[model samples]
Target: MALRKVLQQLENYKSEKPNRVFTMYLNTDLADQDQQGGEWKIHLKNGLNNFEHYLQKDGDSDEKRNFWAVKEKVENYMHEHQKDLKKSVVIFATGEGDIWFSERLQMPVQTAFHWEDQPVLDQLKSLNKQFPKTGIVLTQKEQIKLIDAELGAVNDTTLYELDLNTEDWKQHQGPHHADSNLGSGGVKSSKKDELAERFEENRSRWYKSIAPKIDQYAKNNNWDAIYLVGSSVEVDELERNMNKQVDDKINKNLLDHEEMKIIEEVM
Candidate 1:
């Protein structure tokens, strides 16, 4: 079914209770070539001056607002578990940037510009020691795109929700649409071979970024299994390695989407 919007969810949170609220963020932007090196600065808004209301498509990234959205979701989730958040920690993430947005409705405005330095493949060796309880998980495009279907599934009215999500829908309008660098020609298609290569590259980085979080989450929650979502190929590959520990819903949506809507056709 269609989950209500954030405002509606917030209303429910006010009436809920919790034992504890724990929030954490997973990193994803390390794919950029020649990334930085060092610790990160959290709560900086240096790159948000450009957009008023922009969508994440055709190159120009308004992920600053995306970060703000993450904050909104956290507030809503915290409201659901208000009894526990008095001591909860909300985490936001970026690959080279260990920056996380946590100030609730008003994220800390940035006063300086800094680069992210975290390695994409870096993993925290200690699972239980790293994270205890968790809340909002701020994430990268790559990470969210690969989320397990069950987590973002629609048993009934959710189909309507997905339709609404893509109201001014376009084909392939997932994270790739969000990341593509568009020039004057508008959205351009990469050669299929190139697309394949990019998928592999992303899958590699995603695993690197999520491995520790997965292991840590499992150890903390006593969860013997994990669900994964991704492109049919990428998540499929991920399943090969974590067949027992992870459950994948990779690209199942796209495959079921037999009525193709290539951008050229939609336009």
Candidate 2:
């Protein structure tokens, strides 16, 4: 798309939602064609293909062209299932989804990248400051290992940011099995939805992105709700995890509610 067109789209997006957000990530992956820069294309392709099939509403043959209709579809889905879909930004990261972020067509997003070899703590702290509204998303141990140092002179007791696995699973059996008999292909949502529009409109990107760490957190903590602040791709995952038909032994190591709630506090 032309720069002007992209800018126009972004302006529309901003006018429609100045504070609300949908997130994406720029991550690194080892087994990718462009091994460097996290191969964001992979994530973009995932969403595109998934959305293509997802937009098939009522036997429509060429619904993908209706890119403008995507927002309404997604919003309607949330509206209908407002109870389950927490009215928060949709988020996604690498390994599950590719990065297809057009700054001209969207807003600035929180970033998560493991630099080649730098003090992740300082980098993350700087990023935290840059994206103050979104907060920061990092692994449990990573958050603790690095972030704790940022509290230089600051009281350690005030540190309530890390979402670490701070519970004892000794009482439970073992690792829990996740019920993700998730579809690999040919999955569709109502075409009348924004999800449908996204799938239909985006044919050159990936959308299979979801933060497994977040899912694990939810499963490990037995949470009814959780927050993901990365990309709109996360919402698709939230639906997948939340709408599962059956339950599996995802986390056999069941921690006490009180202990698990501590994890939830930061997540």
Candidate 3:
């Protein structure tokens, strides 16, 4: 995932330079689950406040003591940058009165934090696969749909659809081919073959043409992973013609299905 890549790179820098700071990781959903029932913001605020209070007191726990030293800066950072918090989880690394790392996640984590590496990293690693964002591309000969997938819901407005006039030869069986197969007309057979070839060429070109656009769209939307849903030929053509970076992110291939079902299955 893009977030993991960025975080890992930052972690490497931190390792070499060695900054003394505390990391605040908040899993809003998980925090809310601990509460009887309340808004995400309230749960998040309460969790952080409790931890901050605990850290400020003199304690035998080494982790708590470490957290105490940077409590002021960490609290200020979280308060100032609370708007960055989104669904799932958010990690904010703070020191020097500002956030060093802040990111919203598509996957949830436990609501907790530490002075250094947070437990969230371990959960992400355990998944063994990183998907900062997953997009579903449903394609056919004449139509295509790009859908963004989230934890529990699919954004219907994000569904991008493209329609084309390209026709399917299999569905358009003309008298030309029928008469030719009867051992009657050679010219009709030639025309039939030419038409069939042209149809295939046009269809293949259509798929190829859309590949780059799809790649661009994914990049613009920050989709780190994508699923292809369509006929094998169309999917293969798109994959073959896609930009290398985008092509590498393809995680699944599925036959086109109903929109809701696709979302449910993928999520």
Candidate 4:
């Protein structure tokens, strides 16, 4: 789901009586200086225990029961996704299951926990503003990758490959592995250098041909910003040809890297 829609739903929600919402933002990034010793584990345990202790001391029997139920669900979810956890995890859940939203994000988040009538969304809102909806274009010789992202998570990816036979661009949806020789047609090793030279000669024209396609995609997806990543020649050609304003450019060939790694570097 879109982050905006999720935030709207949380904004509209308000727990009644014994049913309160649980909001958690847990940082699981081991590379973080403060989390080198797995400090987040201790933080999570203490956060949940503090809530339980509070309800036990001041809440009625039904509220206490609701708190316990929510706590169990939260703990089970963390355990199940522990292996796949990314830099951070955010969740908003209710005891009765009216609201259940969980995301393991590639971006870092400050650890927080709350039990209240409404979901605590201040930090999440801040993240949304910081990241927004962005399109990252990774351009190489005969390949172009467009990544649609929001809130430091990939929503979708579109790959455009140059079809040498037809001299046209072919679009493929979702993640794809990079082809070292996209349209090589199994050229002999001896001729590889010649092929590279020819590609360089036509590089600018080829990139310009796809510029309109990228602009149209950005318009259709309502991208807040566009980034170009590749060699100086490749990115410069693409940025010059495209009508949309390029927000930034990175002089690195990241088309073959993992999506999360690309995001981490550029974002």
lDDT per model, in order? Answer: 0.30, 0.28, 0.51, 0.88
Per-residue lDDT over 93-125 for candidate 4, one digit per residue giving the tens place of the 0 to 100 score:
888888889998877899999989899999889
C-alpha RMSD of each candidate structure in angstroms: 22.7, 25.5, 11.4, 2.6
Per-residue CA lDDT of model 3 for 96-158, tens digit only, reads: 333355545545665665554422355445432544456777665444667755443354323
lDDT of 2 by residue, 1-267 (tens): 222232233334421111122233333233334534434435444544454455455344433333224433433443454333211213211211121222111122233322111112333234334322211121121111001111111101111121113221111122222221122122344432643454445312221122333344344433322332222343333335443222211221122123223233333
lDDT of 1: 0.30
TM-score of each: 0.24, 0.19, 0.51, 0.86
RMSD of 4: 2.6
Clashing pairs in 1: 22-134, 22-135, 23-135, 45-110, 96-116, 96-117, 97-116, 146-229, 147-229
Model 2 bad stretches (over 4 Å): 1-65, 85-87, 91-255, 258-260, 264-267
Clashes of 2: 39
Off by over 4 Å in 4: 178-183, 189-205
* lDDT winner: 4
CA-RMSD of model 2: 25.5
Worst 10 residues of 1 by lDDT: 154-163
Ranking by lDDT: 4, 3, 1, 2
Ranking according to TM-score, highest score first: 4, 3, 1, 2
> Alpha-carbon error at 229 in model 1, in Å?
3.4
